[model samples]
Target chain A: MESKPPDIQLRRLDDYRWEVPQTGKMRTRGLIYATWDMLPDIRTDQSIQQVANVATLPGIEGASLAMPDIHWGYGFPIGGVAAFNLTEGVISPGGVGYDINCGVRLLRSNLLRQEAEPILEDLVDALFRNIPSGLGSRRKDLKLTTPALRQVLRLGAAWAVKNGFGTADDLLHIEAGGQIPGADADLVSDKALDRGRDQLGTLGSGNHFVEVGYVQEIFDEAIARAFGLFPQQITVIIHTGSRGLGHQVCDDYIKIMMKAAAKYNIELPDRQLCCAPITSPEGEQYLAAMAAAANFAFTNRQLITHWVRESFEQVWPAGPRALGLELVYDVAHNIAKIETHTINQVTKKVCVHRKGATRAFAPHHPEVPEAYREVGQPVLIPGDMGRYSYVLVGTPQAMVETFGSTCHGAGRLLSRHQALKAAKGRSILQELAAKGIVVRGASRGTIAEEIPEAYKDVDNVVEVVQGAGISRKVAKLHPLGVIKG
Target chain B: MVNNSDPPKSKSGYRQLAHTADLGFRLYGESLADIFVNAAHALYGVMTDRRRIRGLECREVVVEAPDSGALLVEWLNQLLYLFDTTGFLGREVEVQEITSQRLQARLRGEPLDEERHQLNTGIKAATYHNLEVKETAAGWQATIILDI
Candidate 1:
């Protein structure tokens, strides 16, 4: 395919890492993690320039980083990761993108692929019917009162559990224990609350989905077992976010941050990079509001989990517990988290902005769930529905080199229009069916826009992270069914 | 006054631009008001086929921002907010007044009827990435990227 060469100078550091040397205004250099073969496509857009743009942010520590899935985004490139000094660094909503706390959760079940094969069609149909999906989809049966919605913003997944969505034990496997601290409901706008009132359990459109797959390969037996995976074991992956609420919060804050950037006199390489000092009132308010939205997302996924369980039960005639369907782990890919990391052999507090990236905290890190602390946090990398997904474990090297971060997924290789045009004369549903994958989508347009060819091969993306020692692959999963919004 | 019942041709005020994972467009007009109206037309065009929509309901909308660029984002975001909250999809937009910092529009459309309207895109918000709104030799033009 024809592509553009990187606009910025790239000095390769090794087989898996490239360096964008510090230039004019850059406070730190930029580091990109990708294989040599992927560099050409990575440079096809302005994402390389965006990585360098992030380096120009004030008080950025270490380097602006991009994972193998890096792609051009508004300000910070997708798959971008950066940490800033708490007192001097700035907070920008663009760093979190529009979907605050957009993440993925993996569910493991005792039923093997063979056991569910007979009912796969029915199960997928049930899930599609039970879960509200597609553009502007809402749960007519699940509207929340204003006061009730506030609790969701403050409590996240815990709120769902209390409301009888899931067990308290489920929270243990979630990031931040399913609730981010310092989230103030008052910080959220009425518009955001209104948008979120009825979207709690809806799978949103544009790349969001509920996929049923099975463990197809095991790279690490110990870690795979630790994560409750066995050969051909059935699993469900829920990919969604805080819905319209999160979008409004980011939109609302971006407007504020634009003014705040001028108020703080921060020189931005791009208008979308507008920000304010981390300690400034504007920055604090944004963090508080963003946290509230993040909580909403966590709760959103938890509610969906409940419906997913119900769907399985309807098809299998066995309850979730009987089927051994349990949450393996949940992690947010789009978020700005305040964390402590060692830089230059000195430990300091910095705000980590991970957009289209996942936290890969090493084994024994206090934040890893107690059950899996011996192995590490489970990092779920879901691929296109027609292909395969992978489960990986974080490594100590990630903490040292990349602030415990790894690639999120196979980044888009084709524009939506390109995918649509390529799918103009074909039915993607039937195409996937030929491969033994049952697919259901809210709209044919969505299915066309998301044809598997739209994305790069996830195996190649995962290979870079593993080769770089940031994460280690544990198991591979092949999709048998998928529900797209 | 334009008749609300008359079906307008799919105007050539805007054209789609390719974006890797999101949606984008470039719009043109002879005036800033035209730019704003054309931007809305383009916005709704991406969401659904405008030919299927009718000006059954008219909404008076106003927005204020720091500058023209911000005004464009706020204006389109207002339309998005309307669609998300009330399912109101505007097909015909008349810019009543527009300035560098504020805009007023009469948006004419109807509530989304899923059975009739073919939903094409779910736009999250208009973003500020390389956002532009300026006068050119041909006329006024604006570029925008919507986070989908």
Candidate 2:
């Protein structure tokens, strides 16, 4: 296949990590996490230039980082991660991207993978019906009143559980315990609120999906068992985010961050790096709103997750006991979090922006859930609905070198237009069905636009991180069914 | 006329549209501050059919900025806010002047007749994906895309 990687003037550091030094207007170096083989594709991309451009932003710390699945995006490239000092630096909405808290969650089941393979058709149809998808998809049952919705903004997955979506135990398995602290409802616009009111518990369009899969391989015998992941075991994955409200919040703030850069006299090579001092009023309001939207994203998934569990009840007629469905863990992406990172042996608070990145915090980080703290945060990276996904765990190297972050998914290798054109004259469903995966969507174009070939090999992307020691692999998941928007 | 009693601040403001763009109306000013004011008028015009948005009684609209660029998105957002909150629409707009941080301008349009306020794509906000407000050799210029 023709590779479209950018010019990454590389200096190999090892078998895993490589560097792109400052050139042009770059203020710092750029880092690309890939193996020697992947370097050829990295060279074809212009996204490396974006990484250097990102380093030029005022007050950026460490290096501008891109994961193996790197590709050009609005401002920052997808699979990008950067941290800026709040006391002296700025925040770019482009760094966080417009999807807001777009993320992924994994659910484990007691049933063996062999059992799921046969009933995958029924499960896929049930999920597609329960989760309204495609562009502008909404539901009559999930809409919330203004007051109830405000609570969602504050509560996140906890709100969903409290409202009968799941039990309190589910929160223990969620990132940040399913609720980001410091979300302020007052920071949300009424229009944003209105957009989200009908969007909760619903999957919005473009790249959002639900996949049913089974563990295909185990990389580590010890970790796989500790994670309860074994070959041929059933698993479910959900991917979505804060929807319109988060988009509006970033929209509402990007312009402010732009002007704030000028007011503070911060030199920016790209205007898209608009930002303010973390302590500034403009910055605080945005954080509050962003956090609130992050909560909505968490809660949205929690509600949908409940329905997924219920789906098994209706399909198998014996609930999880017969169907064997269980919650494994959930994780978030596309978020800016104020975390304490040690710089020069002293801990300082920095707002780490993971635009298309995921937090892979190592074991014993105080915030990690008690049940899994001895192991590490479970990082779920979903591949295309038609192919496979993986289960990974955070490592100390991530905390020491990358600030506890890693790649999010199999980044797109083709744009929607390109994918649709490539899929022309091909029945994408027939293609997937032949491969043993059943696919369904609200529109034909959705399937065509998301054909597996539209994405990079997720296995390759995962290998880059595991090789770099930022994350460790546990199990591989091959798809059986898909439901997407 | 916009009741520009104060300078348009960061992440917030209002301004007038000028004859700057080639195929579209423009928001021109001395600084990012005032240009945002004109941006509001330009977007308001696009939201309504220019013919229908013209000649409604104009009123004073004031917006507070959390900062400058936020003020700019806030300014455009305010136009949507007015359409959403007050039902006013814009047809033709005039910019008096833009400063390093504020804009003062005039808008001529009719109140959105009850039926015109529903053409929303739920963008709910404007972003800098393709946002450009530059001081060119010819004059001040800017372009913005709303995420609909």
Off by over 4 Å in 1: A1-6, B1-12
List candidate 2 segments past 4 Å from native.
Answer: A1-8, A23-25, A43-45, A321-324, B1-127, B130-148
Q: For candidate 2 chain B, which ten residues in a row score worst on lDDT?
A: B16-25
Q: What is the lDDT of residue A203 in candidate 2?
A: 77
Report the poorest 10 consecutive residues by lDDT, candidate 2 chain A. A1-10
Candidate 1, residues A217-335, lDDT tens digits: the string is 99999899999999999999999998899999999999899899998889988888988899999999999999999999999999999999999999998766789889999999999
In model 1, residue pairs whose N, Cα or C atoms come closer than 3 Å (at least 3 residues apart or on different chains), thus clashing, are none
| Candidate whose TM-score is highest | 1
User: What DockQ does each listed candidate score?
Assistant: 0.39, 0.08
lDDT (CA) per prediction = 0.91, 0.74
Cα TM-score per model: 0.97, 0.79
